[model samples]
Target: MGDENTPLGAPQLAREAKDLVELANTEETVSELLRRGLDWLTRIARFDLATLFLLREARLVAVAARGPLANARVRGHVLDLAAFPMVRQALETRRARAFTEEDHSGEGDPFDGVLDLPPGHSCMVVPLCSGERCYGVLTLDRSECETYPQTVVDLVEVYGQLLATALQNAEQRSDFERLHRQDHEHAKLLESQLGGDSEGVLETSLSPAMRDLARRARQVAETDTPVLLLGETGTGKERLARAIHRWSSRADHPFVTINCAAIPAGLLESELFGHVKGAFTGATKDRAGRFQMAHGGTLLLDEVGELPVELQAKLLRALQEKTFEPVGSDRTVRADVRILAATHVDLQQAIAQRRFREDLYYRLSVFPLRLPPLRERLEDLPQLCAFLLDEQARRTGRRGMRVLPEALARLGAYDWPGNLRELANVLERATILSRGPELGPQALDLPTHVRAPEAPAEKLAEDKPGKVPTLAAVQREHILRVLALTKGRIYGPGGAAQLLGLKPSTLQSRMKKLGIARQELFIIEGPT
Candidate 1:
């Protein structure tokens, strides 16, 4: 930026910046840039392992793996964003910082054990964050005993920012590519249903639950009636809604989604039914509501159960009559959208409690699709993990990952009350933290509360110190205890599986394998 022995002036600096920006914006593929970027960081940082975890869906995904990590191709291999204190701080505030081993060791931090590196080396992870979200992190673990200096931190932040942008851009490019490739294939199918005859759905799931959902979605796609999707939190309801749209007559139109719980009640009404210019404070321009934007396509009302009661009647009117006035406008706008709504809550209970409109409920439930929780679909965990890990590897072109069978076994037994979304997060967390060839239970930051109970008091007193039961034994005892407590039910509340950290169906299979019966242990299933 400067002449020999002299400082550069403003114009020269500006020109240099423009040149750098151009270099960054070149048509080189994102994978190439990411590879080169990691190479550069490894040299500059002198670390043993390095990787970048880009956000996908709602979880962090390892797009690039470098340095000393063995076998990087395992699916959903990632870290929990909300669980990492350093990442949480950096991303939420949009500030760059690093964490060392000394900062760990808190009573209830989500980031425990993440910084434990090979040898005597510590770890450093700089967040690749933008706005309120963290796209990924530039992680480095070094064998040297020296603490990181300010210069290294600054360099890591810059590299992390560029890497995150490259990752985000690559994902968008992939989406465009997928849409292009699938659009033609789905033409006949889209036309049959949405009048456009689209047939295929996004390959969002490798799990049987997802495949089944897609199959059932095809049946609902051809109908003109409203559809309601019911599931626990973290289930991919919006993704399902979009799949429905892609196969419907409205395939050529927009698909819009708005979370009822993410917005305030007063402003949500105006957001859904646009306010006139200057209708109230800050209404400076004419705007089209989500409905208008999604006209002729699908309007996904996410978290629909959270809509305020006052607006429930209004929503019902619009659903039935297909017309609505703006918040401050008297003109009635005709709606041509196929309404698709989703909620994690039980709407029947909401209606009974007078928190929802029964008429609206009837209309939406005309075509109902219930997304089974992750626990119900434990049979699909292995496939889903493989798909997600491979997708991440394919995106960033890493070495790929390896998942041990035992790890998968433990994973399938998890309760997954948070559902697929949670399962995805757990896998994502494991991807970033795990090294070498196999993913083990220690790397999986499952809720600490999920650990096994102490031995029964009688057994503990009888045993020698430091001896622990095998995982299977622990699981068996836990199930037996739950069976005694519940009296009997295998699939309902207080069921053996729920009492333990497992799906009911898994418990049943285990019980059958172990030749144990809830009926023999107890006499009742809880009230439904």
Candidate 2:
């Protein structure tokens, strides 16, 4: 050896350097990779403590720690840039800084207050720099009155460079994976919005109301103006929102959505505006929220009326200024997202009730489109059934499934209080229950009180000559047939009332007017 206190030989340093490079290249998650790097640092440099802090939002957040302070729960904790002089020196000068108890160079250092190192411990800190940017800082400390070897210092500097590159790679991989997932989900949503009809052959609705609504949506989609969708629950506001996105200039970009009512009020702000690391107890890492993710795209705020009062002002600011700072951060981020809001709740009433902001409502409703409920657009029933059944068939692997004409007619008669969503549930359930290629009235099991609509001339033309059934006549026939099938039992399980999906009392009244006697019908022995 050159000297008794000499550092490791050049050959040994070279070997360890090669190993560190190999370790950094391994396929692992960011956290796992960082943990393993810390372990390797301990073995190679023989440090009593090693901690890694990554820069996020101009603060160094503790990501990994080891040694005497290893038991400390400092991971996910943040340290201000100016609070630690040694760390600041290392970062700004792009060099390693070492200090011993005897040196007393940093007697008034802020890190002295933050870090409670034991007496006689020497510490070394290095900046993780790659090119011009410092990725983070690495610290090593030992509870001994000895200085770290020159070779060890050199190795740590190299390690910092390697770690920075590794972190950048890992972050890129993570971003790619997240974007891939978002793209896959958006593709599925787009397919659904197109009604799985890639050729554009399927019509959304033939009803004049819906046609007018679609026309308006297409007209406004080319602009960056905010669009508000107003409709009753399940009236397909989300679908309309998708249509607008597809027709917009940002059609190729992401279309993110959030249901204000579905998420808790306390978390909505964080979900929309993101949060810096250590912003909250569980916010371990920096996350780009919906606004960031939807940059250069569209964001649909469904159930917008459910937004809490306190957040309304912040939302209005974001809408007006297109910039918002993440929670616990002072820096503002630009939001280049087109806003689309959809809600069934009456915004005017909500404003009058002091539950919503009128300015925000005006901003959102720059181009408003109101969708008529299914009951009002009954003319579109046949087409809606076809489109819904096609989707259900594809999902259930029941290809080429169809509904019987009479069943379709019966479905058009009911007042669908729950709108399209309810219709979809009913159709999916019917598809799952039916055994044949065609679903009939038995598969429908509609409530008898919901009578079919008046038969149009075309429907009457399909009837037997001179025997076109009126709405009342069809109701009577449907009720009488149900009674006969139930062996004239009028109430309870398997009774005429139950089979017809009618309340027992209502079925009895209909029977009395139709001249069906109690003697002619079997009375079930149970409560009506």
Instruction: Name the top lDDT candidate.
Output: 2
* Model 2 error, position 152 (Å): 31
TM-score for every candidate vs. truth? 0.48, 0.52
Instruction: Point out where model 2 deviates above 4 Å.
Output: 1-204, 450-528
> Which regions in candidate 1 have their CA more than 4 angstroms from the true location?
1-213, 390-399, 436-438, 451-528
1-528 in candidate 1: lDDT tens per residue? 112223344565444434434444663576665666666564346666676666565466776767664234522266666665665566666545655545554422222244344333456667776434566666665566655666666656665665566556555676777897687457534433332111232343434566677788887898877889988887667767877887788877767789999999889988898878978888898888988887878899999999999998888888888899988889999988889999989999999999998887897899888887776655456556665565556544544675655466567556777776777677777878987546777778887556455778998679875576677777675555445434455565435465466787887888887767655543323343
Q: Model 2 misses residue 243 by how many Å?
A: 0.9
lDDT of 1 at 440: 74
Best by TM-score: 2
lDDT of each: 0.67, 0.76
Each candidate: RMSD to true structure?
Answer: 26.5, 18.3
